[model samples]
Target: MNTKTLVSICSPVYNGEDHIEDCIKGVLTQTYENFEYIIVDNASTDNTPSIIEKYRKKDSRIRVYRNEKTVCMDDNFNICAGYCSDNSKWIKYALADDYLFPDCVEKMVKVGEMDEQIGIVSAYRIAGRYVTSMGLPIEQNVFNGAEILKQQILLKLHVADGSPNTVMYKKSVFFEFNGFNSKYNQSDVELVFKLLDKYKFGFVHYVLTKSGRDKKGGFYYLVKHGFHILEYLDFGYKNLSNYKSISFDKDEMDYLKMYYARAIVSFLITKCAYFEWEDIKRMLGNIPEDIKKEVKKTFVRDFPKHIIKYFVSLLRRIKSYLRDKKRFEQFT
Candidate 1:
């Protein structure tokens, strides 16, 4: 692939006053300069537009466009991506609230330059607050395609490159899929899964994006997206309809179990945090009796102590907020 310009970047911004400055600086200051920065504004009420205007004036490469109306994150990203003129080689959606290392694009461009067939290139991300499920920052190594398939079947959760921030896709291939799902909140995961389904990805083996501020995929965002968990699960199962190998090797099956585990925890934590009993009941209602039993078995085996500590933590959190000293004073 004899590409003249190396890369194109798209950023989706929505009421992101807190971290937009740093996010822009991260891209503009990249050690790799042959790139276009496209900022897609989703009608942010904040001064996000002004900040973008400021950068566009300074750097001839930076471009900004506001969506006609508020669409979903996926559509905003796809729309912003379409705004890029480079369309030359590789593309990456840089989250408005995230920063990246200077060597980021340099390393990814090197990978794509060497390998044209590589549909996707991703690097390790430092999972931060709202950045990942892990409580602390962690690095993600590439999951083998075979292993990824196995994990999808077993875990029922698709771990497509740790963070969307760390992913870079070939521009041609990106548009080939018609971009992203504008309707679903969980479209990010869907986009990655569908991309991998059709094309092979090469792992870049470097740390790129920094979780600058908690934007998307934070605990609350996870709940909002994960609300459609069963829907996503059904989607995957529908796509892989002929998948008959329900039972696999012990190691593989054990790993798959965590998918169900995280799915449960993600949904449950949200319901528990907000005390949304009805939602919890609805989540449980979606699962079959067999899976419920499996869930119970999993709870006991994997997170017995966690379950106990969670309830205790919830009670403590609740107690701290409600100032009902009179009720306690009677007991005292």
Candidate 2:
């Protein structure tokens, strides 16, 4: 391997004892060997630190750093990304719970090398199967940045398809936006919107990663750092007028508002189901009354959809539980 273009692979960990080793191995075993692996531990109390040390001793290319105290997830992510070497031109951010295919870097870099204007290269990711296949076939590998942003704003792009785990970006582009913004729970989506405001994004029609939703730090983490519906609505509201390259007409803007309102109500119902009233109320504080009214209205209209999805999710969980119980029985 020529390994001419140096890529920086960054992963941030906190109490990820179970998944950190496999995550490290996924990076170390990459077929493209010219990359530096940077791992940041956010003062984890678990065995994560030792697991990282064990790998650090074996791989000279691996560099490990520790934060004195735990920081926000976005801050930890920025710290990991900042450790890239001066010579490194590209960065691949791998989440601690995710696994990367061996050819991920090779494939992404190849597409990135096709054009200097290409700021990000993304590949398909598997959660259950091509999760981003939004009932439409993709016909092109390269898309105009403004167009993609427009699709995203219009709710045509699947959010999972735009996750950082399946994407790689140029080092310059990451810094140009000052790394990820911590305000939005969907920080990755905000970054995508900002990047697409100026640069082109390419796609590789291959599944190069598997997304893991386990080990999400449980309930307290959800209350502290989880995605809130209002945050997303606020993001959509705040950024609607900020795009320089793409402009939405009046009708389009109205449609987007309705779209966001529907999403807000769906999430509100979900939060009400799981969280206490006080937590949900605190998250919704300072949000305008008009928005709340719209959410209430949409909740009434969309209540059945929410009920259907809840039942579907419950049934899936039951099936998974039974399957696990059967496997345990067999093993015993």
Candidate 3:
């Protein structure tokens, strides 16, 4: 792996004063040195700009820009993608709240370089205390892009690993697809599906990134921004089936129905718990009537276990809170 292919690390941040420095440092200290770091401050009214400058002055490879007007998450991400250097062949998103391990870029690039067809390279991530699930086990090291798209449609890959920040993609693929879709706030997952339709994916078995989540901000932001989980599922189901490259068999369609059923039910419960009826009504108003009916049907079908799991999840959160409080007290 002596080749020095230029990699562009882009981070689109808003009010990220708390973690922006660490994110920039993670990029600066990457074991792979031939890279450029771009940080887009989306009118952040915090110390984010200054912190970015603190490192920018020290490193010639770092570039910082501030947007005149704020933008949505997807738009912000698009801006980040637009900042990639023309010579950069690879684009890696380093979210402001996430930290990358020293060799993350090196290993991911290694996998991508293994084959000219590899469009995206991703690794297992160590999620902080707040992740809901790690997703279904992908036992293989390299996956056919189309097959992984099928897996995603079947909801077998339904968990946090689909994050764009955890993966590196070929710059050509990003541009060819016109980057992430802005219509869906959860555009990252959609982008992955589209990319997989055309290119192969390389999986690094090691955990190379540390991802963090906020318990409250997670659901609130999506719901407020009109990103319903049901829409994501419905969009994915339709998008994958209609995708010209991938064809699903009868067996796969059956499994897809089962997965969609479970997914709808799970989504309903989470949304119901986190949002008020008014908020759900306002945000979900555009959802089709048939999809709404299916949501109800699935909720009724899974009511018993849904209740049990809801309580169990609540208890787990309480336990986690207590454990964290005790750890903090120890430091005090």
Instruction: Write down the TM-score of every candidate.
Output: 0.74, 0.82, 0.81
Pick the TM-score winner.
2
After superposition, which runs of candidate 2 have C-alpha atoms over 4 Å from their true positions?
Answer: 1-3, 128-130, 133-139, 159-162, 215-228, 268-275, 279-293, 296-332
Q: Per TM-score, what order, best first?
A: 2, 3, 1
lDDT of 2 by residue, 1-332 (tens): 55479999999999989888888888988998799999999999999999999999999999999999999988999999989999899989888888899999988888888888988888778764445524224676676888877877777775323468878988999999988898866687788788887998777777888775443533235434325445555555554678898888888767766776776666567777786666567656745565667667887989998989998999999999999999999999
**For residues 1-332, could you state the per-residue lDDT of candidate 1 as single tens digits?**
53466578888899888888988888988988778888988988888888889889999888888877777777788888787775458887778877888888888777666555567776666766433322211343233344454455554433454556877888888888787776545566666666666565555566677764445545355456455666555544334543332336666544534565566755666566678887778778776454467677765665655667778998998887675775777789
TM-score of 2: 0.82
Off by over 4 Å in 3: 1-3, 130-140, 158-161, 219-228, 265-275, 279-332
Q: What ranking emerges by lDDT with the best candidate at the front?
A: 2, 3, 1
RMSD of each: 5.9, 4.8, 5.2
lDDT of candidates 1 onward, in order: 0.68, 0.79, 0.78
Error of 3 at 303 (Å): 4.2
Stretches of candidate 1 above 4 Å error?
1-3, 129-149, 152-159, 212-219, 224-232, 235-238, 242-275, 288-332
Give the distance in Å from residue 103's predicted Cα in candidate 3 to where it truly belongs.
Answer: 0.2
lDDT head-to-head 1 vs 2, winner: 2
